[model samples]
Target: MPTTRDYEYLLECANVIGVDYNEAENRVKVFVSQKMPPETLADEDDVKKRVQETDADVTVDVVDAGYDDERAGYEPLSTLEVIPEALEGRGERHRPVPAGVSEINAISTAGTGGPYPARVTADATDEASGAVWSDAVGADDLVRLSNNHVYARSNEADLGEPILQPSPQDGGESDDEVGALVGYVPIDDGVRVDVAARSVDRDRESDRYLELEDEWPTGVRRDGYEELREETVTKTGRTTGVTSATVEATSASVNVDFGEGGTITLRDQLITGYMSEPGDSGSAVFLEDGELVGLLFAGSTEQTICNRIANVEADLGVEILTEEPDDGNGDGGGDREPPVYTTTFERALEVDLEGASLDLESVTFGGRPQPGATVPLRIAVVASEPGSYWVDVDGDRERFEIGGESSDDLGHTVTASAAVPEDAAGTLSVSIAGGRLE
Candidate 1:
């Protein structure tokens, strides 16, 4: 259980290393360099320590050159990619308790429609993680809440108990129309509560009003109900504090123009939930089963707004939370290979010579090449116009023309001498294009 601070740090590291979150593995993997032949040490532990200490640039490689030479050590190569983001701290663990839970309080906002309920419980876990009292039933190990209301469940679900849901308006009346409510869920035995609200109001000139947009909600579902249905609706919001009145209006569908004339049509929803508050911007909106639905992004007095989870996932290529594993061991066991992106270089050649002439044909480059690895080039030449020609390679060429051309088309070969620079580390590309004529 990494803290928010830890998560932020990991994100920053990923950005620096140019690695994005891999939703499949729920981890981040980045390509880093290591010095060649890693520092020699006493044991495996020493090797691990040296590997960590070495600057990320050089790499160790094991290769067979067939030659019987001791001094000719294999060149250091970049072959390994490290995954540092996967190492997150697992927080305190707790099991669910059964029985002796009850609701304590319930309240409704003056301008809002529903009679929202709040509950306290005899059970410590229930008390810690706010569970709204409801007739809703859940699976053997989970608690269920109706609609998208905020609620909590014990690690052990057989405890069939109910508690009041916390109210957004729990504190004293607020005169200011704009404000946010904060709640927490304990990573250990602490209490967790979910809150929601809606609001509506006019634009600056009072000429038009804004409303909630309809879109897919977040979270998976077990009950017959489909979570996050696509539907249109209205919303109510308080322009000021809790003391303010409710403002309601219809949500609008508009195309928001963004970077470089690109436009995205946002189908806002008028869903019943809080989407605005000073600090609620990143709060997650989840379905009853605790599946993520959306993120509270923005809103005005006229509408509580949120970005759909599907859209967020599609855009960021990351998942907010994954399904909790059933194993009590606390280890989410699943390892994955890192993702690899590649680039290629290819070209054709054309050459004309009087009688016997050599011309460069074409070059193609590719490999699972690692950063800072010097790649040997492979070159091939073909004589198209029919003539005898001699071919010559400019750099540390591997192959050269040994005899005269036999047919109109002759083939020749050479090795690449290009070296991958440190900065442009990942992969290397080489292309050669030319032909010979005689």
Candidate 2:
């Protein structure tokens, strides 16, 4: 759990090495040019001393000049000499400046102002001929040096606009349109109604088909020219946005089978236009008004399948009723739980000091504590002679006198106060513990 400052520092380090973060993969990748090795204190100490003697004036020249278009032709150079007039009276020896030598201060102020930059060369004239005389710049090394100073400054300027506030939950009108489908019932219409019609009669035998006795007529012929009826319904799925479509042209109940061996069937009337995608298989689908409708089980290439709320309730031995209905309000959106702390408790202890005839002054227990969380501690002691005893836990301490009336069969009772430590992330333990005499 890094803070904003920590993230800022990390970003700075990345910029120094020319890298950017990938949010989707949660990774940092090299995004720009290779980073130059940081100039080290030990390596530049002599050069820095020389520059200081010259009143901060210094000049560098590329002994073997070469063109580098990407870096604006600023060839890698070596510090030839420091001609400081201020050190003319000092014992420092003088060295002649080279002819046609380029002034280091004229290049980049960043290179000349601070500590003298490290010189690197790759030509045959450089020491270790045929080898590139370069300094090492590890990923972490570049990040540590560049993040706080360079990358952070650039990022702050680039992101100039203030952060946009999150939209308020109560700002918009509630949409009552069926949000998601849960289940559906079949209507045995000798003539299946087209999807374009707004409404259809359920009681007309020739127009509607019923699957259960509750929806059937009191007296009807069991055999004749029979027609099958089916209904497609949908519900809101957790992962998939919504599920509404059904598998038509099949005599069996609409059941969707995922290629992964999972199946889901609609046991009641399903809402229309519901769809699902991968990863939404186990999502709980709710009705448009936010009622628990069904649990999405599977989906096909063109349809989704969910277990009906009523059927699920019967199977699980529970009631299927709307306990809380959505009021077209948006306040209830978002995940329900907060982030969990994963840090471990490094140490724990319990102490018992009873029937010990000794000078007992005070005691203390110490450990790293979690912020805003309490730590429990208990202390007990006994002594033959009545005296004053003190106890300390964390940094807080208290004293208690135990004599005659104050002494019980259990001896002296000393309780340690609970506390949360300030340095909650680092190792902390009791450094010392002892008791003093009355």
Quote each prediction's TM-score: 0.20, 0.20
lDDT of each: 0.25, 0.24
Q: Each model's RMSD to truth, in Å?
A: 32.6, 35.9
Instruction: Encode model 2's per-residue lDDT on 250-361: one tens digit a residue.
Output: 1112322211222222223222223654323223333333333344433323334344433433322222221111221211222211111111112333333333453232
| Poorly placed runs, candidate 2 (over 4 Å) | 1-252, 257-266, 269-274, 319-438
Reference-based lDDT, residue 108, model 2: 14
In candidate 1, where is summed lDDT lowest over 10 consecutive residues? 90-99
Q: Judged by TM-score, which candidate is best? A: 2
Off by over 4 Å in 1: 1-275, 323-438
- After TM-score superposition, the amount by which residue 416's alpha carbon in candidate 1 deviates from its true location, in angstroms, is 56
Instruction: Specify the poorest-scoring 10-residue window by lDDT in model 2.
Output: 109-118
